[model samples]
Target chain A: MLYPRFKHFIEQKKMFSLGETLVVGASAGVDSMVLFDLLLKLSHVWKLKLVLVHVNYKLRGEHSDLDEMLVQEKANAASVPFFRFTHTEKSEGNFQEKARTFRRSKMEEVLDQQNAACIALAHHQNDQAETFLLRLLRGTGLKGLGGMKGSSLSKSGKKYIRPLLPFTREEIEAYAEEHKIAYRHDASNDDVSYKRNWIRHEVLQQLKQANPKIVNHLSHLSSQLREDEEALEYYVEAALQKVSISEDFGKCSLKREIYNSLPKAIRLRLSAAVFQKLFLESAILSADHREKIDHIALRKEGGKAQYFLPLNVLFTRDHEKIYFQKENVSE
Target chain B: MLYPRFKHFIEQKKMFSLGETLVVGASAGVDSMVLFDLLLKLSHVWKLKLVLVHVNYKLRGEHSDLDEMLVQEKANAASVPFFRFTHTEKSEGNFQEKARTFRRSKMEEVLDQQNAACIALAHHQNDQAETFLLRLLRGTGLKGLGGMKGSSLSKSGKKYIRPLLPFTREEIEAYAEEHKIAYRHDASNDDVSYKRNWIRHEVLQQLKQANPKIVNHLSHLSSQLREDEEALEYYVEAALQKVSISEDFGKCSLKREIYNSLPKAIRLRLSAAVFQKLFLESAILSADHREKIDHIALRKEGGKAQYFLPLNVLFTRDHEKIYFQKENVSE
Candidate 1:
């Protein structure tokens, strides 16, 4: 069932075209190990060319190196091409942010060398649940709170695909164990100091104990949310089309009458859409910020500037016309 | 902030017409109690009349009677009419299901007595999240998993409004505590035997403890999902208008080519729409059910009996004419 579902997802996304290689990010974890093995088995059936990539961040010292060795041995057994990268520099900022940047950069390099059509990572359902929780903690808006995308474009313009995203971590572990697949253990996963780790070790375990199907439930929720999210984007696009007064040099103005007339929920979404167009980040706009913007559009006097935002967008009223633009540099 | 938002929501929905009384189902719980007080306060400003209705299921013995007393006292203090009903019959089915049915019936009776324009309930953000989780667990499709609506029409044709749907349970609790509003305690809430209660007590609490802001975050996710759900509906409606062969006598047919060409997500949504028109219930068409219909439509058969889903709706094929109608009695 897992293999068939993975095949269907890969084919549906067209993750790999004819003669184009796929770069798999193998972390030597059960999830990634299972994905790597499945891809190895299905490559002939699907006519897929595979390139294995592993990142040794050196954060775990000898353990990380051991994991890289395991992945290399697995790739050797499968007679597949493999690439490995080691990063010695300590990540200065957030561990999650730094790890993400490091992984993406390494993956891009592998893609360029292999000319891979897509980079596949083994982010299963539990990962999605953790992500949803993380985004919620950070006060994310609709898009940010949506968790992970099945297929997204990386920073370097390479396609990143998660074919096993809908599967739970437990399922992946069961598959790996049943197949006698050897994988590395990441000590950081049990640290609990990091938010994701805490969610994984404490929160998710408790939820699983209570329900025994928490990951599946959360994954289902994400898919449902994803569907709803797409529908919302359409309506927001429609509202944007009807209400946008001007868009020049990435500065846009939405007609006040049009903006004010929308329901508050729609108004908040529209505001987020406008900011997304300029900033390209899905920061949660506060309700106060939305209300302030609504006030500017409804009550503020002419020529008065009102700073309404998450991305610091400003709405300046000039008689009946509401001029919207990025805030001045001085302010 | 909550009161103002509630006021804005009620006014926007036009839930109560001019000179018509509004009935609120005030169970004296944190949610309904806050709603009761807020409506009482806003009634003067909005020029509206208010009536409070309470249903004591008598499941919790003394606790249930206490809740009724609290609601009646509060209504009396506000100089508003109060209505109370007690049910001695124990629920034979699930406790939540029985309570819901009883509450709705009581609300209807109160509405009739007051000639109310709408019946209001305090289903805050947490309730919406739980509903979403429950529907997802049950393998529900887009519409069922979409959660609660801000406004809906009851089966008895009475308007139902949930002004606090966007507000989180924490926010309502904070407001109630801040205003020194007295609310009753429902022992059943902590039972954790029911699926929703388990989610509320176990899953959500774990998420909240990890993030400390999970309620608002998940609620934001729901709001975004709602927007997406609306957008999907718009596209579905447009597609129905363009590709629907016919929609008469509670039966409809869609062009196979048009249906297959739609994005998979949209195809699932269209199936849901078609099912909804016939069943008036979104639960009948699961994800697997939609896929089955899609599979039937894709098969290159000339004319055959199409798959009939859980509902009594029978889908058949007549060469180019794909047909959907209620199952014939003789068959």
Candidate 2:
């Protein structure tokens, strides 16, 4: 029953190109298992070549190995290509964030070798709702509120798509049950110590008491914000094009009057984009940094007023131009 | 203690000019009672000529009269001019909506007669959250998500301000209790059949179990959306200026290419603005009406593609220009 919904979503959103290779990120969880099943079912009709990728982080010992084995077996039974990546090293900082980075990089490596059209992930509507709530808690702007993009292209032009984003976790679980699909349940998911786990189990469960369709409403909100954000970004890009006077490898200049004339939203976006370009994604420019830049631009004083941004990027304004320069430039 | 926050909000938001006649809507509820007390305390410092308006709907017989008498007594004690408006007749349609309209009209009449600077309402953070939830449940876009504005000027440029918007209902109630402010509680508010009351008692109360600060967070979301909406509106206005060729009473002309070149958000806003201008507030241009207009403009044909927007306004687009004309005209 949900198959038609998935098909319609893919067709309506044009999530992937037909006759193209696709990489599915599977962890043997219910979400990934359902995604893998659906994609496999639609492969011949859509002319899709499915490839499943599983990474064994080795954190859970036997459980990790069992999950990987199940994913590989499912892929092999479906006659789809299966690949395994081993993670023997652990990184500092948040474990989830590090694992995501590792998985994305590994997937990108595979995508480059296979020239896959897109890598599909199993982020359902519940995940979207959780992300929305988390971002709200941390204080986010409109772009953050837009939540995850349905399809995004990486720096290497590899497309990443979330085909299950429109469906709720319950719906996916129901579909898996109806199809009698085999999946591995991760015990760590029930541990509410993790922020996302807490949100999923504690926060949303309570919210559901008020509105049973809270996840649906949150997903709808993200969709609305996404469209509104695209329109805003389009205008921001245009504003950037109009104000930009010159650009180099790690520097750019904008006419002061023209840049200041832009609305605050566009100004913040343009400045952040410039910082991201110069800093080469060292870190996202913080709201505080943007506020300082806003103040500098508003001041329009030429000499001795330097505004420092994230990743050692410093901006100084002149009577005519606002200059973005790296503090420790080698050249 | 909360006075400084209220004072700072006024100063930061520029809600109204100080030392001027200000109309306060006092309903004898705790929310309004707190607002009245705070304003009276600040009146001397801000040099404001405070005026209070109480609307007695007479729905509760003696209770209604008692509420009005309490408000009048409070105003007299504070040495503020008091005005009472009686609604002996009930209007058709949704009672809440009609009551709101009637109250606003009556307040406006008082505002005009007193030449007040602005009319202040006692809508707090809880009301804002409830409205946010109600809007989500009923299906809304960005504008609806933005909730209520801190200050808005009506069609006739009569200013209305919501000073208590930044404070939660609990905060207002606490203030009232601490100060021992006499207020009449309306028993009808406990009736959950009313959509807003249901949201307040059932929805938000349930949501508060998850996060005690949910009301504050919801208010913050509205504030963020308001800023984003402002930026979007700025771009839309700029686009309108670029595309509009001619505009008069019940008619407008716009360059097709320029209008189509604008982003969807801006296009919808521009078209809705034009429709509003032609119709003169006779009806609100709905999303469906705007979508139809968008389709008509995209078709690029002259005769067969007439769109009837709300309030009997018609739109037609040709190869070069989009024309807006009222349904009936003498010429």
List the pairs of residues colliding in candidate 1: A228-B228, A231-B228, A231-B231, A231-B232, A232-B227, A232-B228
Error of 1 at B109 (Å): 3.1
Report the lDDT of model 1 for residue A283.
Answer: 59
lDDT of 1 by residue, A1-331 (tens): 6788888877765666656688999988888899998887788876788989898888777899899999999999988898998877774677667777888888888888877788888988898888865665676655554556788886557799888987888788888888888998888888888888987888767666546776777776666566556656556677777655444544676667787666555666787666666655765556676656666677644656657554556656655655557665673
Per lDDT, the best of the predicted structures is 2
Query: Can you give the lDDT of residue A37 in candidate 1?
Result: 88
Model 2's DockQ score? 0.30
Interface RMSD of 2: 3.4
Listed per model, the TM-scores of chain A against the true chain A are 0.84, 0.84
Per-candidate DockQ values are: 0.32, 0.30
Q: Return the clash pairs for model 2, or none.
A: none
TM-score of chain A of 1: 0.84
CAPRI classification of candidate 1? acceptable
| Number of the top TM-score candidate | 2
What ranges in model 2 sit over 4 Å off? A59-61, A88-92, A190-213, A241-261, A267-331, B88-92, B187-213, B241-261, B267-331
